[model samples]
Target: MKCSAPLALASATRGRPREFDPDQALAAALQVFWRRGYESASMAELTEAMGITKPSLYACFGNKEALFKKALDLYERDKLKYIGTALEAKTAHEVAERLLNCALATHCGASDPQGCLGVISMVGCTAEAESIRADVVARRASSEAAVVRRFEQAKADGDLPESVCPTKLASCLMTVLQGLSVKAQGGAKREDLQGAIDTFLTMWPRR
Candidate 1:
């Protein structure tokens, strides 16, 4: 991966006093949401974790929902690179393996929080946060749809068997991935997730 510099904030960001590194603040906010879910994480918690006041948080990232959305964007961009790369694989099976293995490592990695922000953002969430939940659901669906499209292309290229259903396979793989995210959040070891990934790969359609 290429190294890039952190984003610099403009002067008097949105006409409010800027107090901290925007990237760092956003990252802190992401972790708060990741660890506490959407509604459970209050402005006090967000500001404390972000090392910014409420005014600064509003100026930098708008309201709570907007901040959560921005955090989700950062989470996906930084953590979900594998999904895009997996689509470029030579076969549908390779695509699934790449996605599953990457997901396992990401969810279980020591560097970041356990589980997935996408999964954590929605569990036991309230109706007040329905839009955020919907947003997370839509993003997950889009990912699964991308997998389905990749599998469709693989089938067209004869990488997959003619009798197999691309959509069904993609949904199955996505289901496993979602389950793995929950397990990882529950403190499942990396090796355990890897074992699950290995088992899932064995079920992948063969030529």
Candidate 2:
């Protein structure tokens, strides 16, 4: 994302005020939410990480919920780029391999915070954060639906066994993906996760 100077308020007057890059601030907020689940992330922590005051955060990004939604959008746009690529695989097995490999890279990246941000937010969510949980669930459902559709096409193209159920397969794959996130959060090694994925793929149904 490109960095641009913050937009000036129309009502601003008098001496010039400090300006911070909105894109940079949003990115910082994303890291905080990624490290700490949405509900557990404190407003002070968000502001401190974003390098902005609470008033500025509110003025630019609305409330915490709104900020989280924007951060989630950023995460999907950036971190989930491999998903689109995985959908383009020539075979169902290839698609599953790419998805699992990409997910492993993402969940266990050395420079990134461990675990999946969506998983953290959704799983750690409380009843008070029902709206946030619902939002994450809806987004996840959409992704799962895309995987299901892709698997259905694969079955139609004879890339998968006729006996395989696209919906169930999609669910199974996603369940493994989520489990990877949990394991990564629990400090599981990359080799261990890779081994598990290999085992699962080895057992994948064939035509």
Candidate 3:
């Protein structure tokens, strides 16, 4: 639960006159952001959720933008760790399987909030928060790029057909991935997403 924000530790040492768990506070903030998008998550709601005063939040996490960034980092590290691991899978098809399955579990799990914080966080960002939207989009692009590179490697290794375009294949998978997140957010069940993933995997490129 500990955040990467150094200010939390620094502020604690400066005699803030209140003892709060930065990790716990950050976890609370993560939930708030997951439930409400970046622009809609007001400081009042954040402070209330984190169980801290405005001053304490500022001292520990910086401004709202900075706080959201930290929260996003935590979200990726905790919730999306599988993406990196899946890239190391034995084959490109296995990589896609691992990714889609993991995504289904993560998004539809009972303990966490529904859907993807990454997908929903920037969906309707205000004009004033265009940079935030761009940031999320860039991260997503990086992820899609990784998949594309993996597919290219697969093509070279003869795991996929020469007719397959790695870039287009990666985009198709990513499109399904994002769509699954949206559907999960809208109350699609785990069984339904799993069924969809199974069907999609059958379309994975073959030699």
Candidate 4:
């Protein structure tokens, strides 16, 4: 269920009436959690970044874990879907390109550029970070499985040779994408990544 935006909650104080745009608020919350992690992300930072009050923050989203889940949902819905959707392409090569360029734009794209939420979340806060970290891990596994399934389909369709192992190739593609994402977060150029993409394309099994 969607809630009101932080904008609406920002205007009015606690106990008073205020309209909020849930999506906008959730998006802002997502950024905060993405940058700071759930434990490190405080209500002040969230409300401040969101331009809303603590009560409004609590009201809109139940608590920190809930907010984190909401943020993850948004990431899954918005960011992670890029690769899965792109893998639906007619050719396996397109699938690879789509995965790489998507990683390029997503992990390193412009405007409030933050590294991957998955990697960022996995990096710090060991004890308090278990649930979110687990979620990200599961999400990644699911994503890899999806890509592998696509590669298997591509082989079945004769888009690639029968001799190739789709799971292995998909694993390679996913690893390449993860590496590209790490490089991208560190300022890897689009063309450089594209060059890598081109290299992968040439190596496709064709017999």
TM-score of each: 0.89, 0.90, 0.90, 0.81
Worst 10 residues of 2 by lDDT: 1-10
Q: Report residue 72 deviation for candidate 4 (angstroms).
A: 1.3
Candidate 1 lDDT over residue span 49-162, tens digit each: 988899877766778998899899999999998899989999888998899888877877755437788888877466688999899999999999999999999999999998
Tell me the deviation in Å of residue 165 in model 3.
0.8
User: CA lDDT of each candidate?
Assistant: 0.84, 0.87, 0.85, 0.76
Best by lDDT: 2
Worst 10 residues of 3 by lDDT: 1-10
Give the Cα-based TM-score of candidate 1 against the true structure.
0.89
Report the lDDT tens digits of candidate 4 across residue range 1-207. 234453244444546565657678889888888777677788889888887888777767877777778888898889878876897888888888787777767765665445677766766557886887888888888888988898888888988887889889888887887776566556667777778878887886775
The best-first sequence of candidates by lDDT reads 2, 3, 1, 4
TM-score for predicted model 2 compared with the true structure: 0.90
Query: Per-residue lDDT tens digits of candidate 2, residues 54-108?
Result: 9888877778888898899889999998999999999999999999999998877
Where does the lowest 10-residue lDDT sum fall in candidate 1? 1-10
Clashing pairs in 1: none
Model 1 stretches with alpha carbons more than 4 Å out: 1-9, 12-17, 111-113
Ranking 2 against 4 by lDDT, winner: 2
What range of 10 consecutive residues in model 4 has the weakest lDDT sum?
1-10
Which residue pairs of candidate 3 clash?
Answer: none
User: Of the candidates numbered 1 and 3, which has the greater lDDT value?
Assistant: 3
